[model samples]
Structure formats: C-alpha cells, structure tokens
Target: MTGKPIDGGAGVVSRVVDVADPADPRLDDFRDLNSVDRRPDLPSGKGLVIAEGVLVVQRMLASRFTPRALLGTDRRLTELGADLDGVDAPFYRVSAEVMAQVVGFHLNRGVLASASRAPELTVSQVLDGAATVVVLEGVNDHENLGSVFRNAAGLGVDAVVFGSGCADPLYRRAVRVSMGHALLVPFARAANWPGDLEVLRDKGFQILAMTPDPQAATLAEALPPRAGQPVAILVGAEGPGLQEHTMRASDQRVRIPMSRGTDSLNVATAAALAFYERDRLRTTVST
Candidate 1:
C-alpha cells in the first residue's frame, strides 16, 4: 500500500509533481551525483551548486544563490511548507526509492535544492562596510571551511576572504556542513596572495594572524576595539600556520592561550575565540 502524503499545516500550499522513472530527463541535474566526472560542483564541469537536507535547503532559499530546481519526497515538501512559497523553482516530487537511484545515494534528508552559482564577489565587495572578517589560507578541508563559515555567522564575522589554497565553500559537503551559511557568508578569493594583505591594510583593517608562537599576543591582548573599525583575523590550516610572508604582512600575530604542550585549537574554534574576543571588547566599551 502507498504511504499517505505528508502534510505540515492547513493553508500551506506545496506543489508536488510525481516522478517515477529514475532515467527521466527531468531529473538530469539530480542524477549520478556520485560519479566523479559527472558530479556537479566540479570547477571544470557543469559546476551546479547543490544544497541537501531541510536546513541547508532553507538556507539556500535565504541566500544569494537562487534555487533552479528542487527534488524531494512529499514529506519534505510538507515540512518546507510556507518556506517554498513564491519560490520559482519547480518541486520534482519523487519516491524515496527513485530519489536514491537517481542521486546514487539514499538522501535521508529528504530534500535537495540546486542553484546556479552566482558571480564571484571581489575582496572589496566582501570587505566593504565590514567590522570583522576572517582570512584563511591553505584550509583545503571542506568540513573545516564549512565550520569556519558556521562559526563566523554565529559569532558576527562580516565576511570571509580566501587568501590561497582554500576549498570551494559552495561544494555540496561544505554547504551542508555549514548549514548553508557558506551561501550567505560573503567571501572572496585573493587575486594576489600576500600582496592582498596590503589592500586590507589600506582599508584601515588591523590584520591579526593567529598563531601558536608563545611570543605572540593572546586573543585578549591582540584584538582592537571594534567601535565600527574593521578587523581581519588571519587563520591558516591546522598543520601549517599562515605562510611566513603572510604573517609578515599582518600588523600583529595573535595566539590563543592554551595549556602548555597542548598545541592549538581547531581553526574554526580559534576563529570563534577571536570573534568572541572582539565582540566582548566591543560590548565592554559600549557599556
């Protein structure tokens, strides 16, 4: 027997289009997502950005990335409810089995949103009117990058700048891990590595490079007053701190106080501390 359609509440409209054949061309964009070459989001390929699960899908709806299409079970449609209202994307309703066959994985999350990537933002664009930002280098781990974006969003970071060797924040895994904050968090890639530090410096931002060096100032001592002033927190990948030249370019090197021999915190955690310190100082000054 077929299962009853899922419904969220009264007066909420959710359009459902029945899709049975996995090979239906209408599902092309959602097919073979596991195939290395055919998988979307590859820079050299079709590069469509995908959002999975309910939270990420909702985030995609609120972000600059506009959804082109949505494929999911009626259950998810009901859950989405008013969230999908006025969305231009068509909802391609499919059974759980068919969706698993098409995507090459059972998406327990039940909902997916696909959006064409918008134009890349420039460093100036992301930095403009910002009071706090995070600069990352060699953070190639999608999970870490996603966590950083999540932490940034929760902790009041205004933007994110990728200095070099960072992963694509728009990657499906990153977007999902970030809970879709990667889409909402404005970011830019530096055209020139260390040289770009000069641009931020010229904008009156105090660049604070996070480090484990005992000699560096602690987060409490290093962060400047916010007072509407711009600040950039420079963070490198876990293994390698910021590049030597990049560190030299910054105005100061800052370290999180940790137990002796404990090394350092995760990049995202460290960034959260920096953001917290900045926020704390900003609040203290105002009080």
Candidate 2:
C-alpha cells in the first residue's frame, strides 16, 4: 500500500497488486481518462484529481491530496522507489498493455495517481501571511494557467486567485503542464469578480494590474513603492488582456517595456515578469 512499510519485526513489503484485466472494478477511477464528454477529473463528472508520471505522483503523495490508488507498470513502481514509502494508497501494478487498455492510451509517464479533490479554499485562506499573489481573469487556457502556476511557485508568488472567466486551475492538462504545481500552489476562485478583488485590497495588498498601455508605469518603477506591503499581480487572458472594470479596480497598472513591433507577451510571461519584479523588490527591502 506504500513505497515501503514500517518494520513490523521485518522489512515492510510494497503493496503492489498485479492486475491483468483492464476492466476490473478496481480500475474504474482510471478508466477512459481521455473521455471528451466525461472525464473523472471533472467536478460534475468523477471528481478526482489525477497526477501523471513519477514526479507528479510524488508531489501528490506530499500534497494535500492523498492518493486512494495508483496505476502503473512494474518499471514505474521500481522507479518511484522510496517515494512511495508509508503511503497508504494501493499501487495497482499492471503491465503496459493492461494500463494502456484501462486508460485508453499509452501514457509514457507510465504512472498515474488518483486522489480525491480537496475542498476549495477561500481567497482569505490562501493569503494568510502571504506577501505576493497572482490574480487571473479570463485566462481560460490550461497550458497558460499551468505556466502561471509554475512561475508563481518559482518566482515567490504566494498564492493564485481566479477571477471571472478563468478556467479551472485543477484541470488535468493544466496540472500536467504545470508539472504538478497546480496541485501544490494554493488557489481560490473569486466568488464575485471585481467585487472580490476589493477583498484583496482590504487585506492591505497593493493590486498591480498588468497592462501594455504606454501610460502604465514600468515594473521597476511601480513595484518599489509597494515593497513592504502585500502585493497582488493581476493578469488577463493573452488576447483580450484585463477587463476594463478589472483594470479600473486595480491600485496601479504596470507594464513591461517591449520592442515596438513585438506583440504583448503571453499572460503567463507577463505575470512572471511582474512576479519576479515584486520578488526582487521584496528581497531588496528585506536586505
């Protein structure tokens, strides 16, 4: 049931069960993972968060998500090594062919862990003692959302807040693209759009909206004044950018300088720049 077992007078045995039949009832959670109309990851659907690959599966093991089951080949079970130790989940060991038939694909990652979705957190819960946060609007693309989360985790953004028109951060594609950061990073949806933004402001966070307008202040110029205060970086979807009302609600608008002919950067890229700048300023201030 775990990577390794505690010595009960002897070495702990791995709880890997050999499964030959793809249609076994135990494999139900992982069946037809690519189902277009009804995947298990959908909240209204099967309502599970799946972590694919050894690294992501390891992250799931350490995260708020507790895997109820893992499906993978013998090679992956060996590759996972000590990471599975003490894990309570059952590792359903299957051959590549059986895994392929069960999941309806030959996922090269080889290992998949399924865990129940944790209850959603509120904006306030994620912001406890958090100095930097990213607020997203209309960023419905899974890859872009994933990249933003990866950036946030790497660049010191403390949490992610989703405003109206944003995609589900927990989507499988987004989680995979984020390299599992979508599961690791703290995120909450704004029950009310522009209105919930005010909640962040009320928490003493200086909301800086990312915009391409020539009138907006550069990141360097805008971030220092807010150095000691909590900061929220607002980013919109790539093409449409921030909604007008969202922009107006922001305490300040910040932009990255770019070449004249170049298009505005991707939302994730822009947010990364903003997050990096905020991180730098806080570092300088702390030092």
Candidate 3:
C-alpha cells in the first residue's frame, strides 16, 4: 500500500501510509516480531535482518543491507526526514496501538527496517587489505557482540571475524545495540575454527589474543611497529577467554595492564582498548 505525502522538510519527502489493520498482510514481515521462537528474522527460520530504531534504520540505509520496507509512527517519519529522500522502501505509518498489536509489544524505538539477509562473506573476503581486525570466540551474548562491532568501527578496526560459538551478529537486538555498525562492519564466520588463524597469519596479520592472565605481554609491548602492519586482536567471551587451542594458534597472547586483583574488562571493552592501543601506537610512531 502506498502512503500520502507528509510535510517533509526541503530535500526530504516522506510517504505516510496509515496502517489501520494490525493483521494486514502488507505488514507480515513485522508481525509477531517479539515471538521468542517464531520471529521472522531468526537465522534458523526466515532469516531476515531487522534494523530497529531510527539510528539503525539510518545505518541500514547506508549499509549493504537494503531495507525492503519500513514501519513506523508519524513522529518517526518526521524524525527520519531527509534520510529517507532517496530510500526506495515504503514507509507504513501506523498508530501506536496498532503498531504495538502487530509487533506483539510496545516498541518505544517506534521504528523498524527489515531486509533480507545478504549473502555471507568468507574470512579472506573480510581480511582483504585489512590492517586491523577483531576476532571473537565464544561471544554468544548479542549485546556484547554488538558493542564490539560499534567499538571496532569507532576505534578503526577494519573488520570482525567470528570464531566458533559466537552469536549471530545480525540478531535484532544486536543490530540495535551496535547503533547499526553491525550492519556496516564487514565480518565473517570462521569455516574451520582456529584453523582460520593460519589464513590470517599467512596474510601477514600479527594475531594478538587478548587475555586476563597477568603474565602475558601488555598491549603496549605486543602491538606491531607503525609501518601499517596488519594486526588481528583476538578476544574471547568474558569468563572462558580464548580457547587454549586458539591461544596456541595465535602469534602472541597479550594482556591489558590493569590494577592488581581486579577482574578483566568486558570482552567488547577489552577489544576497544586493544584497538585504541593499536591506533595510539600508530599515531605515536607517525608523529
């Protein structure tokens, strides 16, 4: 269903279609979004990629994931403004009550963009010309995984690699939590677990596995010299950390210097610190 034109600002034109019926087939992609085991975006099921909130939707517009359609309130349509000018997706405007009924909950984010899952990339594809990358293992928490992607983008990590047991980075909450960086950041799942470490190694990346073990070399001591050398900062879930095999596979095992007796930082935070350290070292050497 097409929408009527709303008072979009100069350079912005918004199509606002009123969605009265919650069960309308046009809104099927957004229906029951909160269903625990039945959501359409589930990778094991319909495998759609959902971008929640205005920022995520904006990122979706900028990323490779092209939104098939958008469903939101009038306020959101206004908020989106010029961001939607060239966007090809339809905007299904609906009342708050009807939206809540369709989505199966009150979505304060007030907007969502759904897209079909794009084809997956391989390890080598993501690693091409990457000078800095973050490799994750056993990071099954969507929020933590999302935070890592956000940190990677802001701190200059070029790409992300998922080792075994990592969560689906495209999960709805993860995409929302990453501020949509998850959609933009290039990533690949390891086809052979720690075996892929050799691929990164052969590509000249210095793999530094992050660890809490106080005996490991500090980030300052482990990072490479500034000649634009390739580096991979490997991180694992909070408690288990990098598997022994993964650690053994890496070129170096590094630790962030911390106060005595303190626990390690969160996994994503730890990855950010490593990325920051790498950037800082590069800057210091360049100057």
Candidate 4:
C-alpha cells in the first residue's frame, strides 16, 4: 500500500511509505544486516552506516551523516516524533514481522536508519582548536572502541584520533555500543600512524601514553601539571598496550593507580579513567 501524508512531528509532514514486502528493492539498504558478507555497514563493502533503535537514529539525524532511508515500524515512527520533521528521506513504515524478515533479526529497538558513510576528517581537522583528544592504537574490539567514544563525549574529550590497527568506528556494532556518541564525537584516522602523531606534537599537544608499567607516573601526577595545556591521551589495545615506538612518541607514560597487584585495566576502562582525570584537572585549574 502506498503511504499517505501524515504529521510526523509538530506540524511537519514526513514522507512515510507503507512497505509490506520484505523483498522490496528500496529496502535493500537495510536487508540482511546480520549476514557476514552482505551487511551494509562493512567498510569494505557498501560502506553504509546503520543506526538502530530510536536514540541512535536520533543521533544519526543530528550527525554529519544524512540518512538515505529509514525502515521501522509505526510504533517506532511515532516514538521518533519530531526528529523526522526536516529529514528528507522516506520513512519505510513496516510491520514488526517485515522488519525482522528484512533485517534478519528481531530488533527489539524496532527502528533502523541507513546512511552513506560521511567523508573522513583529517587528523588536523579534528585536532583544530581541541584541548584534549584521545589517540588509539590496535583497539580492534568494536565494543571497547565504542565505549571510548561514549566516555570521550561525556568526559570532555574534544576529539579521537585513530592510529594503526584500529577498527572502523562507524561500524554498526561500534555505533550501537557507543550509544550513538560515536556519531557525534569528531574523530579522524592517522594517515601516517605513529608518524602522524608528530602532527599533534607540532600543534603543541602533550601526548600522554597510557601504560601499566609500575615505574610510570600516576594519572594524578601526569595530568594536573598539564591542565591548561593541550593534551592527547594515548591508549592501546587490551593485552599488548602500546607498542614501544608508540610509547616513545608520547611526552609522558602514565598509569592509573591500582590495588591488589592488578597489572592493568580493560582498554576502555583505562581510557575512561585517563579522560576523567584530565577533565577533572582541567576543570580544577580553570575554576
């Protein structure tokens, strides 16, 4: 059945089309989301960014990515409310059964939006005017990567810079785990890996590489002294931490104080602590 014009939110009318067929060509962007080879979010494949659930979909609307199409049930459409007012894409209204059939899973969130990947920002672009940024290396775990974005957004990180061996931050799973903060936070890839770190240094950012080495200065000692200065907190993967050369690139090696003889923390947790300390110190200094 063809869609009728409806008040999507406030007084604005949204282009809502009723879609009953799971095989409809327009639904292709959201089809088989769980299929390993056919997932639209594969950076190596369709290169689309998929936002699932109402909250993430709202974030996507406010982000750099403009949705190409949206597929969701009527309940979700009403839940999205005014967020759809100015969106130019068609909202493919479907039944819950059809949504599950098209996406190949029962999405409890009941809504999804598909957008083409936005152009990547350069390291300099994200770092421009930034006071604090997080640099990551070899953090291939999607959930951990997402948590870093979420923490970065909440803890006053100005940007995120990816070094070598990092996963795509826009991957659907990463975006979901980040609670959509991955879409809102500015991030850029280091085109030159450790070499690009020189860009941060040249811009006057004091790079603090995170580690568990007992000899390293604690976060309290490392952050307060640099409170008013531009800083970059560098975190590596869970087990290996930063490479020796990467650690050498930093102005300081810092560790979170631990008890019970614990050697290290999860990459995301460690990053959160570092971010919080840096923010706290900066706040204290400013106030």
TM-score of every prediction relative to native:
0.92, 0.93, 0.92, 0.94
Looking at model 3, residue 151 earns an lDDT score of 92
> Which one wins by TM-score: 1 or 4?
4
Cα lDDT of model 4 by residue, 1-287, tens digit? 12334455335536888999999999999999989999999988999999999989999999999999999988888878767878899999999999999999899899999999889999999999999999999999999999999999888898999999999999999999999999999999999979999999999999999998979999999999998899999999989999999999899999988896567788999999998898773444331
How many backbone overlaps does candidate 3 show? 0
Error of 3 at 106 (Å): 1.4
lDDT of 3 by residue, 1-287 (tens): 12435474334554546789999888888989989888978998878899888888889988999988889988888787777887777889898898899899999999988999888999999999789999999999999999999998888889999999999999988887899999999999999999999999899988889999888999888884633689999999999898899999988889999998789789989999998988874443321
Which candidate gets the maximum lDDT versus the true structure?
4
Question: How many residue pairs clash per model?
Answer: 0, 4, 0, 0
**Which scores better on TM-score, 2 or 4?**
4
lDDT values, one for every candidate? 0.85, 0.87, 0.87, 0.91
- When 1 and 3 are scored with lDDT, the better candidate is 3
Query: Candidate 2 — which residues are off by over 4 angstroms?
Result: 1-14, 281-287
Q: Cα deviation of 62 in candidate 1 (Å)?
A: 0.9
The candidate scoring highest on TM-score is 4
lDDT of each residue in 25-46, candidate 2, tens digit only: 9988898899986688887888
Whole-model lDDT, model 4: 0.91
Candidates in descending lDDT order: 4, 3, 2, 1
TM-score of 3: 0.92
